[model samples]
Target: MIDYIMQYQSEIWQAIGETFVMVAISIVAAILVGLPVGTVLFLCRKGQLYENRVVFGTLNIVVNVVRSFPFLLLVVFLIPFTRFVVGTALGTLAASIPLAVMAIAYYSRLVEQSLLEVPRGVIEAATSMGASTIQLITKFLYVEARSGLMLGMTTSTISFISYSTVMGIVGGGGIGDFAIRYGYQRFETELMVVTIIIMIILVQTIQYTGSLISRMLDKR
Candidate 1:
């Protein structure tokens, strides 16, 4: 195993870098776009401050439609759009377009769910105190649900890592692609095991860090 790693260390490192690039882009989308989308879903629901059945229904349907597609199909289906946006349907950047879309849809649902977990009393209290919409969300809802949001982000990130693996089908190389090409395809079982172990360790570290911070932030 050691000899194998030393022999292909550069390639392995490059694959890991590609994976990071894809996952990083997805993470950014989840925060910048997904968070707001989910917050809107929460605020637009019936009886909420910004309640509007039309807005809620439209967003809900879009989220559902996106989520309903099998991820593999979603990647293939978005090829044209991805190509148009990135000028190519191959490489880490192009692959990231689909990953980002998936992240937005996936994390938005999680965000909505996390916000739903916020107590109704808290929202009511904020309203009674005359909090503006922005204030209610930032100072009340998000403050109360910070821990849940953290956990949700942790979950989304792990799913992103898993999803990035399949991007290799479009020439988006990552650790998984490295394993497939040099391990499975080449009968290098030890290399595959090493890559799997690397992924496991990376996931465990993220989960642990997220959980620790969530616990620290929890007031109750």
Candidate 2:
């Protein structure tokens, strides 16, 4: 146990950094693209501030279609696109390509759903006050949905972490790869236990931190 860690310390650390790169890039990208995509989705719904059935149906179908794809299949499905984008079908960076696409679809729906939970009266009041479509979306809808948005982000990010584990099958480097290589392949039980603990700790920390931040943003 200790011997392996001591022997491959640099390799393990490199894998950790690789995993972080994949997850971090994917999460930030999801937030940037998902938030607006979701906002537009909600705004286009029938009877909303920016109602447009055409736009609503288009975005709705797109998001739903993307979300409905099985993630593993989605990754493999996107391989040619990924190769075009990242210039390769393997490694941490290449792995992020699929994660970002999946995250965008997954989180966009969550964001739209969260924004929908804002009371209708608040939206009506904003509209009555001459709030433009953009104003209503950015100020009222988002403000009301802030907590849910945070929780949704936390949830999606954690899911991405889990997804990264499977990326290793494609040679995407990460802690999961480490566990699989050292623990499963080499029959190193202690190494597997340690990696499992690390994953648990990482997940718990993300959950607690997300809760604290969401609470701070919530006045009610």
Candidate 3:
């Protein structure tokens, strides 16, 4: 184990950093874009306080289109745009564009769903108290659904990590890149075992931490 780490220490560390960068950038971007999109969807959705057929229909279609594309296909289709934006369609940042794109779509729908679950009565009560649109949203929508939103975001985060392994196929370096290049391709089952174990451990840690934080924040 030490020998493997020693031989590839620098590379492994580099991959770890790249993976972290990918996940962080993706999460932040997703939240920023998804929040408003989801909030709008919730407001405009049928029977909501601010219901609008046009806005809701457009958002629903766009989000559906995004989610319809399989991740690998999305990555391939994004190459042209990725190259245009990043000057190369391979590497950490480039790989993350698709991941972030996917995250926004995936998370926006989840957010909409979460906000929808915040009872109509609660929103109506807030408005009866003369809450402004913003006030109602901040107070009623977010406050009521905070725990569910956290869990959904946590699920998205863990999911992206697993999906990121596919990026390694396109030369986006990470433990996935390492595992695929050295372990799978070269038929090093032991190396593959090590890498898979590490990924499992990482996911479990994230899940536990997220659940704890969600519980801590849950007033209900």
Candidate 4:
């Protein structure tokens, strides 16, 4: 283990950094884009504020279509768009474009579900207090559903990390790329084990932290 660490220490560290970069950017983008999209989805559903079948149906179809595509296919399908956005689709930055896109679609559904978990009674109470649509969502729905929202984001982040690994197949550099190049291709079992360990550690850390935060924020 020490020998492997010493031998590929620099490469391993670099791969770790690249993985963080990809996951961090993608997850942040996912939260920013998904939050509003999901909120809109919730509001437009049957009997909710701003409800409209045409609008809800249209957005629903788009989200489902994007989400249903396999990650690998999405990666390939978005190559042209990724190139146009990032000027190249073979590096960390380029890879992040697809990661963010997929994350947005996946996380939006999670966010929508989280928002739906908000109690209808709370919404009614807020409405009785003369809460505007915006106020009801911002104050009642968001506050009440924060715990679920956090959990959803947590789950999405973990999924993003796993998806980021697949980017390695497309030349997007990360620990996954490192594993493939050294561990799989070059038959370096120790290096592969190390990478796997690191990934497990990362996922566990995120899961624990997210759960803790969610628990703390959950008032009911």
Candidate 5:
């Protein structure tokens, strides 16, 4: 294993870098796009301030459909759209299209759930104070739900890393792709074990950090 690591140190690093790139894009998509869509979903739900069954139903279906697809099939399903967006459906960058989509769907649902946990009284208090819609959400809703949101983001990011592994199917090279080519396909069992260990460590670290932060942010 050590010998293999020494021999492929550069390749391993490069693959790790590619994984970071894909995961980073997914994180950005989840934050910029997913977070807002989720906020909208929460606000537009039945009996909420912006209640609109039409809008909620449409977005709900879209989110559900995207989430329902197996990640691999989702990759295949998004080929044309990915190609159109990135000019090719192969490579680290192209893989981001589907990753972003999945991240949005997955995280939005979590975000909505997180927001649901916020105390109703907080919202009512803001309303009584004549807070505008923006003020209510930013000051009361998000402030109260920030911890849940952080934890949700942490969970989504870890899934993003896992999802990135399969992007290698479309020539999107990453640590998983390297493992496939050098470890599994090439019968380098030790190298495969090493990659698995790395992934486990990465996940454990992220989970611990997220949980710690969530606890710190929780007032109750």
Candidate 6:
């Protein structure tokens, strides 16, 4: 183990860095897009703030369709689109397009579910106080759902980390790619074990930190 680490320390670190970069970009993009998409979904639901059957139904269907695709297939299917957007579909940057897109759909649903946890009475009270749409969402809904939102973000982040690993199959650079190339392909069991250990550590750390924050933020 020590010898292996000494030999490939640089490569392992580079792969870790690349994985972080991809996950960071994808998560940030997903949050930016998913937050609004989810907010709109929450508002437009039947009998909610901006209730509109046509809009709500349309958005709901779209979200479901996208969410239904298997992550691997999604990556393969989006190759052309990813290529168009990023100018290539076989690297870290190009990989992020599909990762972000998938994360958006996944996280949007999480956001919607989190928002739904907010009490209707609170919304009604806010409405009765003449809270405008923006005011209601910003002040009441978001404030009430902040903890859940954080938890949702945490869950999405962890999930995307796992999904990002699959990017390695298509030349996306990351620890997963490193594991595949040197560990599995080259029959280097020690390298595979080390990468797996690193991944486990990364996931556990994120999960613990997320849970801590969620607990701290929970006013209830």
For candidate 5, write residues 1-220 as lDDT tens digits: 8998899899999999999999999999999999988999999999888999999999999999999999999999999999999999999999899999999999999999999999889988999999999998888888999999999999998999999888889998988898999999999998899889889998899999999999998887
Q: Candidate 6: where are CA atoms >4 Å away?
A: none
Off by over 4 Å in 5: none
TM-score of 4: 0.97
Q: lDDT per residue, candidate 4, 49-118, as tens digits?
A: 6898998898889899989999999999999999999788788898998899888889889989998888
| Model 4 regions more than 4 Å off | none
- Tell me the TM-score of model 3: 0.95
Clash totals, every prediction: 0, 0, 0, 0, 0, 0
Better lDDT candidate (1, 6): 1
Q: What's the lDDT for all of these models?
A: 0.94, 0.87, 0.86, 0.90, 0.93, 0.89
Every candidate's CA RMSD = 0.8, 1.5, 1.3, 1.0, 0.9, 1.1
TM-score of each model, paired residue for residue? 0.98, 0.94, 0.95, 0.97, 0.97, 0.96
Report how far off residue 160 is in candidate 3 (Å).
0.7
Model 6 Cα lDDT, one tens digit per residue, 51-100 = 99998898889889889999999999999999899888888888888889
Give the per-residue lDDT of model 2 (tens digit) for 1-220.
Answer: 6787887778778887888898898888788998899988988898787799999899889888888898889889989998999899988888999889888988999998898888899998997999987788788888888999999999988988988888886688899999999889999888888788878998999999998888887766
Error of 2 at 129 (Å): 1.9
Model 1: per-residue Cα lDDT over 1-220, one tens digit each: 9999999999999999999999999999999999999999999999887999999999999999998999989999999999999899999999999899999999999999999999899999999999998999999999999999999999999999999888889999998889899999999999999999989998999999999999998999
- The model with the greater lDDT, 2 or 6, is 6
**Candidate 5 lDDT for residue 177:** 93
lDDT for each residue of candidate 3 in 1-220, tens digit (9 for 90 to 100): 7687677778777777877888887799778998789999999988888889999999999999989998999999999999998999988889999889999988999999889788778987998899999998887889999988898899989988877888885678777888888888988787777788778988998899889988987887
Candidate 1 colliding pairs: none
